[model samples]
Target: MKPSAFEYHRPTTPEEAAELLAEFGDDAKVIAGGQSLMPMLNFRLAVFEHLIDIGRLTDLTGINHDSGSVAIGAITNQATVGRSALIRTSVPLLSRATPLIGHFPIRNRGTLGGSVAHADAAAEYPAVALTLDAEIETLSSAGRRTLPAAEFFIGMWTTALRDDEILTKVTFPIREGRSGFSIAEFSRRKGDFAMAGACVAVKVDNDLRVESCSIGLFGLGSMPIRATSAERSLVGCSIDELQVRDVAHAAVSGLESVPADLHGSAAYRVRVGATMVARALKSALEEATDD
Candidate 1:
């Protein structure tokens, strides 16, 4: 199916894009790589009167690192972020999770900000952002504001971004001391969305006890739900297989309401969720020790 008729505008600057969005209001849809939006358009799930293409906006296309965090431009492609040496060193979790998004071709065209803006519950980057407590920067004619990951994702295919607001950048805090990060997904195939998945970030103190940690799960809830119970379970515990599995089980307590789509039964998703969480935790622990 083809998308309905819409006026197309390619804005050279974010301000211009914002102006177009403001003019079109809810009838306008901002597209970057067109990886996600195009699919929705083709399916007729999204209808817009004005299509604003912002991929060519040079202002929104770079990766920068600061003393405390790394900020990636909204239009930065997945492959670029995945292959960046700075990103690899600053936030290894992103480097590790980008490939799990789709495939080489998709990664080449998919933009990080676009993915976050689209806010697919099962997407890897959103879970990573939640796990790392990343911040999303939004721009509008009014001004700009930064939103924490937890507040950014409102629901499935929905975000805190307003109609006139454009997500401009995503920033993640640099892991300070020894850290471990890993992702595990239950995809039917390499490029498919996960039936269930988990991303874990762990910081260990010199004593080898978990200083701080976060676990984000997809295919478990309406949005990427934080495994708070699991995080609490690991706070003082030494990293080990049994401990990880136990915490993973604890994480499933409040997620009993997961949707049962064509991917799998809710029960099967619970099982996969448990397994992915455990695997991600163990992998994160191993990486922490190696570091």
Candidate 2:
């Protein structure tokens, strides 16, 4: 199947892209890499009257790190991210999770902003963004504004970005001190979307006691969710004394809606999700202790 007929506008600059979006309003959709959008369009799951192509906008493609965080330009592709030493060093979780997003061909054409903005519940980047509490930056003719990751994703395949707004950058705070991160998921194959998955970030003291931990669960909710209940339980416990399985249970305990489909039942997905959480937490703890 082919996408519905639409006008394509290839903007040379981010501002020009924003102007095109503003002009077309709800009828326009930005295409960068088009790895995700093209599939949806081909299936007719999504339709737009105008496709404002930002894939070639160099102004929206780069990686920069400051004192506190690293900001990645929206058009930066996943293949670049996977190879970037800065991303691997500054945001290890993201780098580690890169190959988990489909296969290399998809990653070669998939953009960071496109994935985050697509907001797929089972995607690794969204879960990592939530786990790291990254900041999402957007631009419009009106002005620019930033939003916390938690507030940025409001629903399935939906975000807080307005129709006329363009996502310009995503900033992830640097993890310093005793920190470790890991992501785990259960899929049919290496490139398949997880039936359930978890992204874990941990900060521990010298004695191997937990200082702070974040568990972001995906594929078990309407959006990627922070396992707050589970996190609260682990923050004060020693790794030796803590029950990894118990923490994983707590991670899925607070979930209200775990969608059941032909893929799996709600109970089955929650169980898989819990297992992934346990695997991720254990791996993260090992890394943290090694530090």
Candidate 3:
């Protein structure tokens, strides 16, 4: 299916994009890599009178690290981000999760910011962002503001971004001290959306006890599930098989809603989600010990 007729504008600067969005308001949609938006447009899932293309904005296309955090430009492609040595070194959880997002070609055209803005519950970036306590930066004619990942995703395909605002970048805090990260998911196919997934980041003390941990679950609810219960379960304990199982159970214990679809039932998804969380936590623990 072909997209409906619309006015297209290519903005070279974020200011120009902000102005275009402000002028068009809800009638405008921002297009970066076009990986997610193009499909929505083709299928008529989303329609807009003005298509604002910010893919050419050079300012929003690099990865930079400062202190203990890394800021990734919104327009940076997933392929680039997945392969970035800087990201692998600074934010390994993101590096581990990016490859799980579709295939190489899709990653080539998918933008990190686009994924975060799209806020697909089954996608990898949103969960990773929540796990790392990432900050989302947005711009508008009214100026700029930053939001925590938890506040950014309000619901499925919904975000706190206003109609006239554009997400410019995401800043992720790097894990300090001895840390390890892992992501696990269950999907029908290699590039398919995960039926259930988990992202885990763990920081350990010199004695190898779990100091701090972050667990993010996807494909189990309206939005990415931050497994705070599971995180708390492991904070002062040694990361072993028994502890991992306890953490996994805690991760899904309070999920009030589980999506029921042709793919699986709510019970099935919760079970799979728990397993994925256990696997991720175990992997993260192994890596932490190695470090």
* Model 2 lDDT, full chain set: 0.93
Query: Which TM-score value belongs to model 2?
Result: 0.98
Q: Candidate 1: misplaced stretches above 4 Å?
A: 240-242
Pick the winner on TM-score between candidates 1 and 3.
3
lDDT-based ranking: 2, 3, 1
lDDT of each: 0.89, 0.93, 0.92
TM-score of each: 0.97, 0.98, 0.97
Off by over 4 Å in 2: none
lDDT of 3 by residue, 1-291 (tens): 989999999987999999999999989999999999999899999999999999989999899998889999999999999989999999999998998999999999999999999999999999999999999999999999999998999998899999999999999998878888999999999999999999999989887788999999999998998988778878778654346776788899879778998989999999999999999988988888894
How well is each residue in 1-291 modelled by candidate 2, as lDDT tens digits? 999999989999899998998999989999999989998999999999999999898889999998889999998999999999999988999999998999999999999999999999989999999999999999999989999999999888899999999999999999998899999999978899889999999999988899999999999988899988789889879889989998999899968778888889999999999999999999999998884
- Model 1 Cα shift for residue 140 (angstroms): 0.6
lDDT string, candidate 1, 34-140, tens digits:
99989889999989999999998889999998889999999999999999999888898988999898999999999999999988888999999999999999999
What CA root-mean-square deviation does each model show from the true structure?
A: 1.3, 0.9, 1.1
